[model samples]
Target chain A: AQSVTQPDARVTVSEGASLQLRCKYSYSGTPYLFWYVQYPRQGLQLLLKYYSGDPVVQGVNGFEAEFIKSNSSFHLRKASVHWSDSAVYFCAVSAYGNEKITFGAGTKLTIKP
Target chain B: GGIITQTPKFLIGQEGQKLTLKCQQNFNHDTMYWYRQDSGKGLRLIYYSITENDLQKGDLSEGYDASREKKSSFSLTVTSAQKNEMAVFLCASSIGRGTSQNTLYFGAGTRLSVL
Candidate 1:
C-alpha cells in the first residue's frame, strides 16, 4: 500500500521567506509523487508531479519538489512565498500498477506580513 | 482545457437519509474518481471508474455506492447520512490509466452537511 506522510500540520512563515514543506512516502514499487494545493472554498489543484526523470521537479508559482528515494521523501520548496500562497498543501503518492493515489494529512500554510 | 462539474454545491440532509451527488466532466477522460475530504484527514478515495460502467472500490468504499453510467459522468451515493456529519466530496478525472496520463483534474467540490 502506498501512503504519504506530511509531518507538518501547520506552518507559519513571514512573507518573502524561504519555505519547505516536508513529505515522506512509503511505497515498495517505483513511486509517482505529486503536490496538490487547495485554497479556501476551492478544489485541489495540481502543483507538480514526479515519476522518473530528474529528481527535482518544478511546479507552478516558483514551487518545486525533490524526490529523494533513499529517504523516501518528496519535499516541496519555494525560494520566497507570498500571502496569496497560503493554503493547504497535500503530498500524494501512487505507483504504476496502483489505481489508488494516497494523500497526506495536509499542511496548512499561513504567511505573515 | 476542460472542466469537471459537480451538482448541488451544498447539500443538507437529515440522519438516515440517502443522498446522491452527481459529477460530469467534459474532458472526455477515460477515468473518473470520487473522494471524500474531512477537516483534519486528507482526501480519501471512495470509488473510481476506469471506463464507462466500470466501478472500482477504494479504501473508503464502505457505506457508499458509485455509478459511472457514461464516460463523462460519475455519481456517488451515501447509503445513510450520519448526524452532524460535514464533509466535502470532490470529483476528479484523468485522461487514461497509464502513468503518463495520471494527472487528476478536480471539480470545485460539493459540501455536505447532515443534521
Candidate 2:
C-alpha cells in the first residue's frame, strides 16, 4: 500500500527564518507528489506539485519542494518565513494514472516574532 | 475561477441521529470526493464519485453513505452519529482522473459535533 509520512508534528520558527518540512513516501512505482497548506478554519490550498522532470519545483508564496526519487522524499522549503506562513502543512502522493491520493499526518508550523 | 461550497459550516447533532452534509462545486469536474478529518489523523477518504450517479466506497465508508445524483452536487450522510464525535468533513473535486490534471480543489469543510 502507498503511504506518506511527515515526521514532525509541530515546528516553531522565528519570523524571517528559513523553514524546512520533511516528507517521505512509500510506493513501488513512479509517484506524483504534492504539498498543501491550510490556514485556520479554511480549506487547504495547493503549494506545489511534482510529477516528473527537474527535482526542484517552485510554488506560490516563495515555497519550493525538491523530489528525491532515490530517497523517496519530497521536502518543502522556504528561504524566509513570515508570520502568515504559520499553518498546517500536508504532503500527499499518488500513483501514475491513479486518482486516489494518500496524505501524511500534517505538521503544524508556528512562526514566532 | 470555480468554487466549491459546503452547506452548514457547523453542525450540532444528537447521538443516533442521521446527519447529512451537502457539497456543491461549480468547477464542472467529473470527479468528487468526501473525506473526514480528525485531529492527529490525516484526512480519511469516505467516498467518491467519478460521474453523476456513480459512487465508490473508500477506506472509511462503513458508517457513511454518499449520493451523487447530479454532476455538480454530492452529499454524504452519517448513518448514525456517535456520541462525542467531533470532526471536520471536507469535499473536494478534480477535473478528471488521468496521468495529468488530477489536482483536487477543496471547499471549506463542515465541522460536525455530536452531543
Candidate 3:
C-alpha cells in the first residue's frame, strides 16, 4: 500500500515569508503524488500534482513542488506566502493505475501578521 | 467549469438512527467518490463508483453503504449513527478512472453530528 507522511502537524509563518511543507512517501514502484489545500469548513482544493517529467511542477498561487525520486520526497515550496494561503495542507499518494488515494495526516498552516 | 453539490449541509442524528447524505454533480463525470474526514485524520475514502450501477469499496467502507443510481448522483448512508460522532462527509467526482484524468472536484461537504 502506498502511504504519505507529513512530519509537521502545524506550521506558522509570517506574511511575505518563504514557506516549505515537507512530504515523504512510501511506495514500491513509481507513485503519483499530489498536494491539496483545504480552507476552514471547505473541501480540499488541489495545489499541485506530480506524475512524471521534470522533478519540479508548477501550480496555482505561485506554489510549486519538487519530486525527488532518490529521496522519496515531494516537498511543496513558495517564495512568499500571503495570509490567504493559511489553510490545512495534505499530501497524498496513489499507485500508477489505482484510483484510491491515501492522504497524510494534514498539516495546519497559520499566517502571522 | 462544473460543480458538485452535496445536500443537507448539516445533519444531526440520534444514536442507532439511519441517515443518508446526497450528492449531485453537473460535470457528468464517470466516477464519484465518498470520503469521511475527521479532525486529525485526513480524508478517508468510504466508497467509490466507476459508473452508474458500479460500486467499489474503499479503505473505510465497513460501516457505510453507497449507491450510484445515476451518473450525476451518488448517495451514502450510515446504517446506524454512533453517539457523539462527528465528521465531515465529502463528495467528489472525476472525469475517469485513469491516473492522468483523476483530478477530483469536491463538494463543500456535509457535516454530520450524532447525539
Q: Candidate 1: where is the Cα deviation over 4 Å?
A: none
Model 2, residue B53: displacement in angstroms? Answer: 1.9
Answer with 1 or 3, whichever has the higher TM-score: 1
Task: Tell me each candidate's RMSD, in Å, in order.
Answer: 1.1, 1.2, 1.3
Q: Write the per-residue lDDT of candidate 2 for residues B8-101, one digit (tens) a residue.
A: 8999999999999999999999989998999888788899888899998877899999999999999999999999999999999988756533
TM-score of 1: 0.97
Task: Report i-RMS for every model.
Answer: 1.7, 1.5, 1.7
Model 2 stretches with alpha carbons more than 4 Å out? none
Off by over 4 Å in 3: none
**lDDT tens digits by residue: candidate 3, A41-61:** 677989999888999999999
N/CA/C clash count, model 2:
0
User: What DockQ does predicted model 1 obtain?
Assistant: 0.63
Which run of 10 residues does model 1 chain B get worst, by summed lDDT?
B94-103
Q: Write the per-residue lDDT of candidate 3 for residues B1-115, one digit (tens) a residue.
A: 9999999999999999989999999998988999999988888889988889999898899889999999999999999999999999999988875663368889999999999
Error of 2 at A57 (Å): 0.7
- Positional deviation of residue B43's Cα in model 2 after best superposition, in angstroms: 1.3
Sorting all predicted structures by DockQ, with the top scorer first, yields 1, 3, 2
TM-score of chain B of each: 0.96, 0.97, 0.96
